[model samples]
Target chain A: MIDKQVRTVAEALEGLQDGAAIMISGFGEAGVPAELIDGVVAQGACDLTIISNNAGTGDVGIAALIGAGRVRKVICSYPRMVGSRHFEERYRAGELELELVPQGNLAARIQAAGSGLGAIFTPTGYGTKLAEGKETREIDGRQYVLEYPIQADVALVKAYKADRWGNLVYRKAARNFGPIMAMAGKTTIVQVEDIDPLGTLDPETVVTPGIFVDRIVRIADAGKAAA
Target chain B: MSAADTIQRLDKQQLARRVARDIPEGAYVNLGIGLPTQVANYLDTAGDYFLHSENGILGMGPAPDEDHIDWDLINAGKQPVTLLNGGCFFHHGDSFSMMRGGHIDICVMGAYQVSTRGDLANWHTGDPDAIPAVGGAMDLAIGAKQVFVMMNLLTKTGESKLVEHCTYPLTGLGCVSRIYSELGVIDLGPDGAKVVEMVDNLTLEHLREMTGVDLTMAQ
Candidate 1:
């Protein structure tokens, strides 16, 4: 029997270490694995490097973790938001480092890491400050900037449904970074609203396959809680 | 009344409607956050065009009513939005691929500054105290087939945003195709900035003095 289901958020985050590179999946409040993030906060891992689309919105989830002084750096496309005071304060106080990449380049770089690519040449950042330190080449007539993959030691993902084998499906826009992060993380932990029996989810609708996900924690009320 | 006394600029809604008029029917468009988002309102009555939100939605609709708000469904700006019939969602990788792959027909963005050569500078002001965030600005600037900018022609201090060259950090080079501003509409290309229209009672000479860049009248 191949089962990857875990009973609690603590068990799902077991063996986490300090100074780890973690990819927290979400775009704004949608699809954020808040429970797992809270577990990381409770687990007390320090010096974490987080990669996400946004830094954090309020004093919750990623914001709470950063507020707890757990994160040392953030690599994301957009970190400035309405309630992102913690990230701003930490950044201004010289306590946190930021690497701001354009959104397309950020997604492509993460995809490249999961696909086992050395690097990608994207037209998004060409002729801009984001491409300043990188190598550039003109393929045909269009210029492209070389961007490297962003790999993580662990990825925390939120999905709508999953099976014991860990095949996952997500809800609407909440699916933002879950699938890609699942592949890029060496040990991917997923918090799903429901864990179905074997062969329950139609294979055609599965977004992330079992091979990419390592552990699944069922948080039945996560959707309402996040709302 | 004197011509100067009669001069009037378009309001933000009027400017948005002006930009909306230029979008061809059935074009796939992405509107950047802030002022450019207003374009969607005018677009509703125009024709059938698909709205693309960078967070992974196509066929995106207007803001949902309070009762229908879903936290799981939101726009790139993180505002609650409705998904129209035939709408679909994907992950970040596929969403950005649709942008960088040149599948987006047009993108309307708000600008801090734009050069006569079509260079864009909206991501940052180089302020030392600011925490810079780029988001998807660069991608939409360069990736879309036609890039249209929506902004006020002048800063609050009365300086022109359309310049000979942008002083701020660049987002993309030679990417903008047109600019819709409070004062008028201008098209950018290899030739130079050409005036397509101007507000009533606004003269070419006064427009020239305000812009600081040489302008040619469109034939």
Candidate 2:
């Protein structure tokens, strides 16, 4: 059995270099690996390509990374949030690049990458500006646009629970993209609230198995002792 | 009174009520952000309907009490909401699959303009001044089995949102099936814009004059 447990955030993020393509899992504030991201910020890597659903809001999550000038480009569904001034300023000044993908297409592309498929045809984004410069075909009298896979060198994921083997179980809505990001990353590091004992989590309830996860770190609990 | 007179329009809650009355029982619905989110507060809980949020929530309920609000639980708009008894949450990818796989029965969204031929433009005005945030609008427009648009009939400058052709960038071509405005609701059928119903104190001719598009009253 592989022992993927690591003592701290730094050890989980070993070999992370500049200009790496990374997937930071989250939907708004939910499911964000804050400790791992803090490690990346502390490491001060630059010119990274980050993919997620939103471009981070306020001083939390990906906004902190953007504030550190770490992200050169962001491929996401929603780049503009209510108080996301960092990305807005950078984008307006042409200092940053944005790929505004439709939400469903974004997921399918990432899934295709993990499944070892070269590309996929999606009915979403057809006959819109998003379809521009992409190959489109009509299958069964319906229009579909061809989208490529989105693979990442590193993925920072968050989960509620993990056993010694790195199998994961998520907490409610916080499971947004962690499972899929685990599948698409070459190095999948997950931060969990608790590291359950071996066989503590039911086999059927495991959202992401141990094979997809590379390392596991237990984040310090806020206002309480670490689990 | 001349056509230039200030015609009273339905407020946000009233427009939401209008949209709520049209939802059928046992239908799985997706509500877009902004004004469309208000429709949830008006839905009859006695009916069997489920709300889907693109942010990975199904069976989404109305805004929760401030005391009971959970930060980890939110809708696509990032606002705190309640989850009904049958509510379940999943990954964002699976949420989009439910949206794109034609599992949604209806999707109600806000729009900048909707053409008579059922073309929709909501994401961007194509103006250099605006920031483009498309979100999940494109998926909802084409992927939902039926598309419903809810917005003012005219802009703040009084230009008709129901137009001969949309001036803004199209969100989806010929995807809108129904439009709900403050003044009236019109169906974009194969024939043309058919008037379904109207607010009190408005006429078919007035709606026609206001919209600048030919309006046929539905039988």
Top of the candidates by DockQ: 1
Alpha carbon lDDT at B123, candidate 1: 97
Would you list the clashing residue pairs of candidate 1?
Answer: none
User: What TM-score, to 2 decimals, does candidate 1 have?
Assistant: 0.97
TM-score of the B chain in model 1?
A: 0.96
Give the alpha carbon lDDT tens digit for every residue of B1-219 in model 1.
656567789999999999988888889999999999989888755467899999999999999878788989999989999988888999999988888889999999989899988999999998878889999999889899999999998999999999989999999999999999988999998788999999998989989988889998889
By summed lDDT, which 10 consecutive residues of candidate 2 chain A come out lowest? A218-227
Task: Give the poorly placed runs of model 2, Cα more than 4 Å off.
Answer: A223-227, B3-8
Tens digit of per-residue lDDT, candidate 2, span B58-128: 88888877677775678888778878889998887788888888999999999989998788999888987
Judging by TM-score against the true structure, name the best candidate: 1
Q: Report backbone clashes per prediction.
A: 0, 0
Instruction: List DockQ for all candidates.
Output: 0.76, 0.59
True contacts kept of each: 0.90, 0.65
> Cα miss at B15, model 2 (Å)?
1.3
